[model samples]
Every structure is written in structure tokens, then in C-alpha cells.
Target: MQIYKVGGAVRDRLLERPISEVDWVVVGASAEELLAQGFRPVGADFPVFLHPKTGEEYALARTERKSGRGYGGFTFHASPEVTLEEDLLRRDLTINAMAEDAGGRLIDPCQGQRDLQEKWLRHVSPAFAEDPLRVLRVARFAARYAPLGFRIAPETLALMRQLAESGELQALTAERSWKEISRALMEPRPDVFIRTLHDCGALRELLPEVDALFGVPQPAAHHPEIDTGEHVLAVLRQCAEHAQPLAVRWACLLHDLGKGMTPAEEWPRHIAHERKGLKPIRAVNTRCKAPRDCQELALLVGEYHSHGHRALELRPSTLLELLQCFDVYRRPQRFEEFIAACEMDARGRLGLEQRDYPQAGYLRGAAAAVRAVTVQPLLERGLEGAALGEALKRERLRALETYKAEALGEPSDPPETPRP
Candidate 1:
């Protein structure tokens, strides 16, 4: 049997990128023969094995046929007769269809190298339409290679649009859809992922809440971009620029969804959009089965991000309520994430990209000052049960109030007399 390196390992190597993992395709080998040689069989859909020493995956060269719909509707044929070219033909993109032999000989029956040099994302064959997941994969590749100036071929884009229009995108499961989406959000230009899906009409099917924001208007004074959708993309780009974690990025993407539901009669003004956004945010989170951290952060941002942006102007009590809303004492890191997402929103507008967001630092300082208040002092004073809880809260609020007063260069409130 002849083993050849295939897929992303070969593609990334050709582009001079750092290779993370290697996959091998064993040509002219039957599954039984590999099993006899002490290889561990692992593939449920086809013939895949684990190398006894290296532990890397070794899939037999195989061909696939479309049996039904979505990504699962496929039949595979793997035998000693399957050619390397046949296995390559079943891949999604031309760049991923190339392979390399042990002797360093290049195999490019699909013109992948030429497309790579031209900076194009082209489909390998008509079989590309068989799997709906390829649409998201191509968009993700666009996001990954966009910094290198890659563009999806017009023909391939047309095919993607065709698939989107065919209503096949809904066939993907939530887990599978979220897998592609979350990965795309982590790319350097995640905005391109959403834009590409929207261009192909998949956004409306897969993320209609986000899609609704495209034409919605925002106050030009606050959001120079004016389009809610454009503002969302700008926020996402800022998250990437800051290298924020996935929860922050996801919150940035979904925070403004409520603006789309604003009454057009109130044009350019979404007075309560922060509160209005909670439903759609919850809907998207439930649909995607989002992680607890992501869902909780997104919901909080949806409900109170405006408060974060206006933190310096908030009343001391309001700031205390906000701190409690996020439970900052127990999850300070999540509070930091909330601030990062809010800062992204504040800066993600036309001509405001470089503006300062003092709200983040102000809120962080408030949380720190409150967290410093020890409940042990109140408990030591014989406070108990509800009285103890109330004392602790009052102490935290007093510290936060003094912190806010210092920040504003104002005189602090007189200390409260101890209750009998």
C-alpha cells in the first residue's frame, strides 16, 4: 500500500502556513488488510484507522456518492481499486483535493495549485453541491484566507447561492451549524463569514435574527454607520482586533438584534432596544445550543449593554445593581468580557472607531471597589440572616458610591449611622 499526505496538511504546506495536523490516505489497501496489520479501525461511515505508533488518522482512499440530502446522505466505496485521484475528487474545494507522496511528488489533478496561486476558492467538481455544509466551509475558508486576498470563484459562488435558494441549508443540525458558525467567528475577519452567508442567502435561513438587522436604521449621531447590520459587523471586527474570546465576540455579533425590531416610526431611535433584544438573543442561543457562558454573557449584554456604555453617568445605586446583575464578585472574568463586548459596540461605528471608551475602566473600577468590601466585618458585628445580607450589600454600595464620588471629584456621602 502507498500512503500519501492529503487535505489541509498539503494545502497549508503549499501556502507556507504552520501545519497543525497531518492526515494520510492509504491507496490500494483494504480495511481488512489494515486491521490485520494491527491498525485500529475508527471510521463509522467509511474506512479510517489509527497508526499504531504515530496515532495520526489514516483513511483509505475512497469515493463517495450522493444518496439523499444534507451532509449525512452519502455512500462511500473504499477498496484496493480506489485511485488517489478518485478520493481527491470527493473533496469540497480544489485546494483541499491535492495530495503529496512520500517522495515529495505533488499530485494536482484538480488544478488546486493554480487556484491557490491565483487566490481563488473554487469547487473541485459538480459533486460539491451534494453537501450543504460546503457552503459554510467555503465561507469559513474565505474568512481564513481573506487576509491573503483570496476570493471565491464566481461560478462557485453562484453554486452556493443556488444551494441557499434551494432551502437545503435548513437540513443541517444545530450542533453542526453551530460548529461552523463558532469557528467562523474566531477567524480574523469574521464579518466576512456573515457577509458571505448573507450574499449566498444562507444568513436568512440560518440566522434570521441577525439577517433582520441588515436594513434597520440607527441614529446617525451615535452610529455614523446608520445601518444596524453595518454596526454589528464593525463590532465583530473590533472584537477580532482586540483578540477577545469567543463569548465576547458572540455577544458583539448578537447584541444589537433588538434594534431591528424597533418601530420604524421611531426611525433612527431604538429607545429600549437593549431590553427588547433579550428575546431574539435567547432565541438564537436556544437554537444554537450555545454554551452557558456564551448564552449568559450574550443575554446580559443584550439586556444591559447600554448601561455599560453610559456607566460613568449612572447613579451609584444603578451601578451597584449592574454589578449585582453580572455577579462580578464571583465571576470577575465574565464581567471583563462584558466590558470588552460593550467597548466593541461603542467603538464599532463610522468615525468612532478610534474614540475612547472610558465606561469600561469606570465600571471595572466600581466592581473592584465593591469586591474589596468584606462581609466578615458586618458578620463580626453580630449581623445575621437577612440583616447580614443587607449589611454586606449596604457596605458594598457604600464603597462603590465613594469610588464613584472620587472618580467625579465630588464629596462622598456621610457614613450611615449603625442601626440598633
Candidate 2:
């Protein structure tokens, strides 16, 4: 039997990057042979075994053909007769189709080496056009390789655009779409790749809620984009502009997604958009396989202005009371992300005045500043765990008492005593 390393392990090794996992394809080997060699057997679709020692996956060499549609539509066949070339021919892209033997002899049956050398991401065969999920995969590849200066070939892009326009993208699962998006967001210029998805139409299929936001108008007092969706993406960029956690950044991306579907009457406001925004975003969390609590921080950011606006009229104790409401969200960075969202939301409006772009926390610097003033007292109180949490509720109320009138044009109130 011949053993060859395949997929990401090979790709990472070629790039001189850290290799996290190694996958192998064993040709001319039967399941019994693998078992004899101490590989553990588990084959639901195709023959895949785990190394008895390291538990790494090793699949028997196999070939596939499209049996129907979408990603799960493939049918595989393997025999003692199949060649390695037969297997590589079915890969989605040239760069990923290359394989390396145990001794590191490079196999280039698909011209993948040429594409890798040229920093290109090109499809391996015409079969790439059969699966719409490839559209998302290519976009993710562009994001991963963009910082390294790789580009997709013109013809490959043409095929992707065709797939996108034919509504083939709709067949992709929410889980699959989100996986690519999560990877793309981790890249240096996710917008570069995400914008390409919009042009290709995959964005419309996977994020119709957000797509509907593209041109929706904001009240002239707030956004320049005419829609909350653009504002959210811009804000999402700002959140990731730093080395923030993926959850916070993703929350920022979807902060106002609820506004698209829940249009406000009486001219044009989302009427507590944050609260309304959470229901659909929660649905997204459920449908897209996002963490159940991912929505918590995003909802916190969303509700802040609306809630903060109302919190203004309350005393510090009352404001603290409102702060208690946020305990369910629980992200340490929730307040900071909230301010960042506000800043981006404000700056996104068309014809934003200096007043509109209030010299305060809708942008991160101001948000940080407000956080410092608000958070310092809580930190200084020497509260730990539960005490610290309870203190934060009071501290937030104190800040609301401090900034409410200044920021939201809401009525002001005096501060109140902190809990002992």
C-alpha cells in the first residue's frame, strides 16, 4: 500500500506554516489491512481509519462523482484498482489537490504545484462547477491566501459567478456557509473576500437578512449608507481591526440584522431595533450553528443605545438596576463592543454632522474612554466574582447617570449610593 499526505497538512507544509493536523490516504489497502496495521476502523460513507497510536485520520484512496446536488451530493467508489490520479482529479481546487508521499516526493497530477508556485487558487476540474458549496470554499481560500497575495484565476471566478447567479448557492447548508464566514472573518481583509461573495451572490443566499440591509435607509440624523447592514459590516471591521475575539467581532457583524426584516413604521426607525434584532439573530444562532450565547453580546450592543437612552432618566440606583439586566450577556467586553457598535452605527449615516459623529464612543476611542471612566470605580472596589458583578451593575448605572443626557438627549439624574 502507498501512503500519501493530503489536503491542509500538505498546504500548510508548503507554506511553511504551522501544521495542526495531518490526514493521509492509503492506496491499495483494504479495511482489514488497515486494521492489521493497527488502524481503527469507522466507515459510514467511505473507508476512514484512525491511527491506533495518534488517532489521526487516514482514509483509503477513493474517487467520487456528483450523484445529485450541493455538498452532500457526492458518491464515492474505491477499489484495489483505483489510481492516485483518479482520486486527486475529483478535488475542488488545484492547490488543494496536490499530494505528497511519505518521503515528501511531491505529486502534481493536477498542476496544483504550479498554482501553488504562482500563488493562485484555481479549480482542479470542471467538476468544481457542480457543487455550489465550492463558491464559499473559494471565497474562504481567497481570504486565507490574500494576505499572501494569491488570486483566483479569471475563469475560476467566472464559474463561481455563474454558480452564484443560478441560485445554486441556496443549496448550501447554513452550517457550511457559516464555517467559511468564520474563517474569512479571521483573515486580514475579510471584506475583500466577503465583498466578492456579494458580487457572486452567495452572500444573498446565506445572509438574506443582511443582504436586505444593503440599501435600507437610516434616518438622515444617523447613517450615511442609508441602511443598517452596511453600518454593521463597517462596525464589524472595526471590532476585528483590533485583535478582538471572534465572537465579539461576529456579534458586531450581525448587530443590526434584525432591522432588515422588522421595518419600523412612522417614517423609518427600527423602534428598539436591538430588542427586535435579537429574535431573528437568535434564529440565526440556532439555524447557523452559532453558539447559543453568541447573540448575548451582540444583543447587548444592540440594546445599549435604546436601553441607555431610557436609562438616562433613572437615578444611579435605577441605572444600576438596568445594568443588572445585562448580566445574562456576560461577556467581559460587552460594554466596550457596545460602544464600538454605536460609533460605527453613527459614522455610517449619510451626511453625518460633527454632531452626528459625536466626539464620543460610537467610535472605539470614545467608547474606551467612557469605559475607563465607568469601569475604573468598579475595579477599584476590590469586589471579586459575585461582588464584582453586582458592583458592575451599579457602576454602569453611575455612568448612565453621568452620560445619559450628554449622549442620548435623555433627561438627567443624580447619582445614588452603591451597595455596601
**Best model per TM-score:** 1
Error of 1 at 386 (Å): 0.7
Model 2 Cα lDDT, one tens digit per residue, 75-166: 88877667788878888888888789978898878888778889988898888898988888898788677778898898898889888887
- For candidate 2, the TM-score is 0.74
Q: Distance (Å) between predicted and true CA of 239, model 1?
A: 0.9
The 10 consecutive residues of candidate 1 with the worst lDDT sum are 411-420
| TM-score of every candidate | 0.96, 0.74
Worst 10 residues of 2 by lDDT: 411-420
Q: How accurate is candidate 2 locally (lDDT)?
A: 0.67
Note the residue pairs that clash in candidate 1: none
Off by over 4 Å in 1: 410-420
Q: lDDT tens string, model 1, 1-420?
A: 999999999999999999999999999988889889889988666699999888999999999998977878898889999999999999999999999999989999999999999999999998888889999999999988999999999999998998898888888888999999999999999999999998898899899999999988876666778898988888888988889999999999999888889988997888888888899999999999989999999999888887887787788899999999899889999999999998888878887787777777788899999999988878779999999988898888889879987886753643211100
